[model samples]
Target: MQKNDKIKFYSCLAPLSFLYGIGVWLRNRLFDWGILHSEQYPIPVICIGNLSVGGTGKTPHTEYIIRLLKDKYRIAVLSRGYKRKTSGFILADSESSSWEIGDEPFQMKNKFPDILVAVDTNRRRGIQNLLSLPEKDKPEVILLDDAYQHRYVTPSLSIVLSDCHRLFYNDKLMPTGYLRESISNINRTDIVVVTKCEEDMKPIDFRIIEENMKLRAHQLLFFTSIVYGKVKPVFPSKACFLNHKNIGKEDDILLISGIAAPAPFIREAEKYSNKVVPMVFPDHHMFSKSDFKKLEAVFEKMTSSGKLILVTEKDAARLKNNPLVPESWKNFLYYLPIVIQFCNGQSFDETIKKHIITFSKNNILQNKYE
Candidate 1:
């Protein structure tokens, strides 16, 4: 939605926002006062989350941390597995699909088969289950995806991500804006990362944001931007992987996504193809035969023979599993993968490594095992 459109739409619902804010405030206060206990464990627990309802780039940031420490530590990733059909704790295995363990967890499992991936609505139980694995098989470090608000298990390190384009500072409470909690709650975070930033973001812009946030001395800040990778087939056939430059300027790209933010994907696709047609859906939308038919109609309308369908990796997880999706369409469909690139990577990397290292030295689990 455009800024002015969001402002108008939210303004109409401003009254409900007051009640929503109160509920969030009370919950936070309970946690703050110890009325609601937050459990702490001996081993290091790192959490990556956001204050907004969606579109903060938490998944990529969590993946970045995993990539950083996976070699040195026996890492496990735990999530609530939003929108999954099953309940209770479930571990990702050969049988797991996007439907069984949710798209993100399934994607993570596919990407990092060596690491432990499990999901439970009750994060504390999930942690306990992970710890219960045989002594040698137990994870030394746990990466909690999107669990900052859970508060039941207190993470050793908390990193809160805020989108550079749609910052928490500029947002309001739920019904009024994207923020799930007040911006002030960011004070609880150990690190604040500004994500989806431009590659050439000005230092003055950083200074302006820092001043606006009024961050505490204990809190560290960093900036990162998205780096798109080559577009590859969703299902292997005769289709060859193609980079943006290799794709013909005359090719008409059909961009399909069911994500909170499709603007970035759309913007990136336009750079690769002269004629880009977008087919957007609500976040985490389940595809039906009707949807596929609509997509086919759009594909048929394209005049250029050099045509392709593009999707995000997360979307690919859902689409690849749908039974209604035709095999013919799957051959034409490709998904773009993305990674987070820190603006000042050296400092970010050093700080994260130092914190984890320091925790390892001081943690009781490390002492016992070592």
Candidate 2:
């Protein structure tokens, strides 16, 4: 069920949420008091994460950072590999599958093959492994994807994202709501981003959000909206050529998404076609043979002559190269790509670049003196 569908039960779960909040508070306090250490690395480490459990657009934001810095720096991305089958630190290679490295990481490796992508539950260990590489291969900067609560490694620049649709300020602790921790913890961040905002959001709406967040003078705030790219075939070899422009009112879209949030994706599909049938699944859900059979059944039942199967880029990562997917469905399977566009993009870019430049200069001076 969608998060909105569970809202009515939040009151009943309040007691459980309170207990969960207490445990979160104590753990954070331990780290704050230095009873639990947070390791600091010499190289620049930027974290893109959220206080909420999922659907804040962390992966796309991480990809944006990679695009910004990859030209000037050797970049490395470290993630927990959320639902992968493996358990140790593993760097992505040609042979790596979404089942092995997690879908997001696998997607990154495929999109930006030049950069380093590694996964481990231990953030510190993952960083150490990346740093141990030869000088040419060692990354100059490390991007931590979804490590906000994993306070074992202190990031040089911490960016926390909140979905505009479900702002953390309006949210509650787990069991009752989506927040992993208290909204007060947002004060620890260097930058806060409101993700998945409407492209044409009014100025008044922006001010309303800004006032509610109450960020510190030292913290930077930005708003970003999703920009859906062209529809690309998941299985290019057997795909029937189609683009977003080709989709029309007469079309019937069978949208298959295994993401935390599918509302936005469904809305996008609805713009082109009035008839949209969505098959929603849990985040990081692995598609099985039974699921494939259901998809086939659904697609075959659609009456429109112009019918297609649509999925998010993250879901496409898991479906790609899978043995269970039937060959007949390949022609209709396509995934939409999404990228973030900041309200004031130049300012956001400059802020990130300035920090990296300063870090590099300081590191050089320290090396000279030592």
Candidate 3:
């Protein structure tokens, strides 16, 4: 976290990253020489992925794509289902829980009940399963979560997301730094999105990011933000939504979250309630016996201190399905629904729509002939 400590850390990773760079070169060479083949999907596959490990807001962007295309196209989302137990292709259903389908997929399924969602370690198999389904069930466009480094399949349109606060150009690969691949790999992306932008990004600041960024011939940049949901109240007995009348009338607010990045939730929670009791666990930490007990203790403390419990929609995504959350916090707990919003407004929408539609149409025709 400190400057000298970080320098020492990257110092260790530098040599290992150099070796890792060699491996990547060889792999790309094999594919280039036509020995190792890249798989192709029948339909247009747009990948929303990143180079880093956590907190780029890909899920919100993926959800945004789902929301945008739900009415027009038969859309499906494919994820590696990181940290999930299962190996084979798993489609989320009404009966599906986080344990079975993973956190993000289940959240997507719950958000857009009409859309199809699935997860698999082997993406090709997942695509095969979707193709095997009836024509009407087949997706016209499939969104792959965290597939930027996946060279096995060639995505029709690849959108690489980077945090504006923590751009890859400023950092290095992990062990060495935090990059998954080399700066040259940015060439693979069609569009580069600057996610989680500060609301008041200046023109000069935008230029600094672009100038430092390792860009290919036509790689585009877009800025986005987390659009927080409306502030609501916690009732005692029934499910009561918040309105103007009961804005700050809640007893107190308790913030609980389990996300790779809990900053957004904490910031938003603080905006509504100054006295917030925050409960955060590790990312993707499934509830264990002790974990549940800890949460119970935290809840008890909050209640005793006269605070109502509130959680991110993501934490609630898993907890609402499970029995870990006690009946006491059940009525009080709430989750925030976030969506990726472009700061530039219509210009951003137009650019994304233009590129995707053109890419989809062109890829469709090309695949039809091939």
Candidate 4:
């Protein structure tokens, strides 16, 4: 069920939320007081995370950072590999699968093969394992995916993302709302990125949000909108080669997704065709033979001549690897890739570059002093 559907239960469980908030607060306090130490690495460690449980556009934003610094630095991304079957530091290689390193890390490895991608639930040990590599193999910069509350390793730059539709300030603690911690915790973050803003958002809207956030002088705020690329076949086959944009207006689309936020993706697909049918699933839901049979039944029912199955890029990652899915369905399956476009792109880019360069200088100075 969707998060909004659970609102009635929130009030009934409001008291539990109070206890959850206290636990989160106490843990952060210990870290702040040095009772819990945060390990630091010499080179830059950039973290992309959110205050909420999910659906703040962390994957695409992490991809944005990879695109930015991949050319300049030897970059590595370390994630907890949420829901993966394995444990410990398992590096992505030729034999890695979504089940081994999680879907997101596997997706990143496919996109940027030259870069390093590893998964370990223990952030400190993960970093150490990456650092233990040969000098030439070690990454000069590390990017931590979904590691905001992970105070075990202090990131040199903490970029906390907030969904524009569901702002953390407007939400409550878990079981009551989506926020993982208090909104006041944002003060600890160095950068605040408001993701999924409308393309036509006005200058006054930006100012109003900025004022509402009451950000600190040191916290740099940036706004970004999602840009959906042309839809391509999930599994390339000779029989099916048409892109979503190539389809006629009269076409029917069968949208299948297992993502935290499908509203944005569904809206985009509707723009291409009016008849968009959704086959929704829970986030990170693994597809089974029964699910495929149901999807097949749905596809067979669509009487329209121009019809195809479409999914978000993340969903495509899992579906393509599922052996239960018939080969015939693969020919009809397609996915749309997404990227973040900053509203104030120049300022955002400059800030990231400056932080990285400053860290480089500090590393040199520290080495000389030692």
Candidate 5:
């Protein structure tokens, strides 16, 4: 499918929303009645999710929180393993490949070895398994990636990240628009962060977003940006070089991205490279033999001679698993690790800390993540 198909736009299916609402209500009823079950992990669970469609910066934000809490707490990250070939709670290992766990979780495992990364389509089962891990490996808290819709496991702190560009409050439910749930669901979030802001974003932007959003009584609002700094080339054997500053410092970045949106990647790439050539793909696109040959041929033509190839951290996760990547090309293929740091710095972390503290004090973060 093309990129536009993935975008949540207003649909003519609004008449079926009554049916949609019924499905929503019945699903909740099942869990509420214990007919369908919910599992509470034996540790604190913090979830970063969006009520709408993609581009809320959930992954980077999740990585940020995980890194922040790792020093003081043993943490584990659980994701649905969204489009993997496998289906089960597969724990991440240095030896574990993305084929079994999918790219995102595998990427998480590679990025944070100290933390346990688990993937399963059934989120309820995933959390249960994590909680069941040995005491030493048992995390103080579990970070559920993209789990706001997984109603089975109730997180202690539910952080809802929204885009300043698109607020759910102004949108309609799925198929009708981007919203996964009704805008009223904002009430469920403990905090709302307007992600992907400009470095010099004015107060007017924040005011515009906040003014448009229908905030709940308990939800706190904040803004954040992508602090792009350096880009490192990925090689099969761990062989590479940088130009005093870094790789991708030169012009002409050919960006190969299989993500929700290529906009952010393009924007970041332009900063380091003179121009960006985006080879966009459907989210979680599986590379085919024909596709590989086609892309390699394209990359070969782009480079022409000297080393210059760049891929996002997500795409690199998949590439790392496949042995097909030539050792020589590995050194040329660059990947940049991005963290969602606030425009200022400590304020966002501090805000999260306060919410975590509150959860602890209220005993809400206890052994019941369900």
Candidate 6:
């Protein structure tokens, strides 16, 4: 659709968006007035989520927190497991697949097998289950993934991420826009992170973002940019080893992505190769046999000798052990991992550590007194 047509379409949905906003407002008020209760766990619970509905790099930020605290304290991650086939509080194990748990949860479980990862629709119940584990196995710090709107569980330290490309302040409610709640609701968060920032972002850019956010005095703000890692084979056992820095101008890449934000990924891929053909599916899409066949066709048709297929790490989680993937495509398929690099790295680290330390000390005092 043209720009005008798109604007008209969103305009048409404005009323519905208003209705949705009312429902969200009422629910929040109920919690605020004590008509509905928001459960608070004694152990430190850190929530990493976003006000907008789509990708704000929650997973990488959550991983960043996990890496910061995993060594010092036993860590567990709980997610709503969006689009998973299973239900209730199911803990991840070696036998778990992306089908059983969501792709993001499964990916984290694969990367950090020692850490506890579980999924459930009910965030409160998921945390309860994690806390109920045997004394030695119980988690000391529980990371709540994508739980900003899950008002039932009050986190000890809530971090809300916003995409640099689409700040919540510039967005409306669902249908008309991508936000799950009012921009005013941002005050509920302890920290706000602007994700997917340019590596060389100017000081002026940060100032503009901070001014637009109008954050509360109690809230902290930080900016981060994506740092793409070396390309690794999705099927490492089946594919021959290739040097990570092998991609060059001569290569043609077939970039397959099932993510909310593909522009950044595509732009990064374009930097490596002259020709990049992207095949984008919906976020959290479960690739079927037809999707694999289409991918096989796209990769096979590329005439360049240095042609290969590339995907995001999240997509790789869903495709890794799938039976539908053509055998010929395995050798050429690779996934790029990403982690966030904070603008004020040391400050962000210190702030997270301080929250955890304070929580631990208070918990100890309470237990001793009891």
| Candidate achieving the largest TM-score | 6
After best superposition, candidate 1 residue 325: deviation in angstroms?
A: 1.4
Q: TM-score, each model?
A: 0.95, 0.96, 0.90, 0.96, 0.86, 0.97
Query: Where does candidate 5 stray beyond 4 Å?
Result: 1-13, 16-18, 25-42, 236-239, 243-252, 303-307, 326-328, 357-370
lDDT per residue, candidate 1, 222-330, as tens digits?
9999999888888877467667788887899999999888899999999998899999998878888899999999998887877999999899988777888877776
Show the lowest summed lDDT stretch of 10 residues, model 5: 243-252
The global Cα lDDT (0 to 1) of model 1 is 0.88
lDDT of 6 by residue, 1-370 (tens): 9999998998899999999999999999999999999999989999999988878999999999888888898999999888888888899999999889999999999999999999998999999889899999999999999999998999999999999989999998997999999999999999999999987789999999999999989999999999999888999987776664778787889999999999999998998988899999999999998887887787878888878889999999998757788888888888989999998989999999999889989999999999
Q: How many pairs of residues collide in each model?
A: 0, 0, 6, 0, 3, 0
lDDT of 4 by residue, 1-370 (tens): 5677666666678999999999999999999999999999998999999999989999999999999989999999999998888989998986788889888998899899999999999999999999999999999999999999999999999999999999888988988889899999999899999999997889999998999999999999999999998777888762366766677777888899899999999999888998899989988888888998998898888877888889888888787677887887776788889999999889988898899999999899999999
The weakest ten consecutive residues by lDDT in model 1 span: 236-245
| Best model number under lDDT | 2
Clashing pairs in 6: none
Model 3, range 251-354, lDDT digits (tens) per residue? 46667778878887788777766567777888876767687777777666543344566766666667766765566665566666777888665775666567
Put the candidates in lDDT order, highest first.
2, 6, 4, 1, 3, 5
Looking at candidate 6, the ten consecutive residues that score lowest on lDDT are 239-248
Off by over 4 Å in 6: none
lDDT of 5: 0.76
Between candidates 2 and 5, name the one with more favorable lDDT.
Answer: 2
Clashing residue pairs in candidate 3 (N, C-alpha, C atoms within 3 angstroms): 13-175, 13-176, 173-177, 173-178, 173-179, 313-336
lDDT of 2 by residue, 228-273 (tens): 9999999998997787888888898999999998899999998889
lDDT of 6 at 116: 97
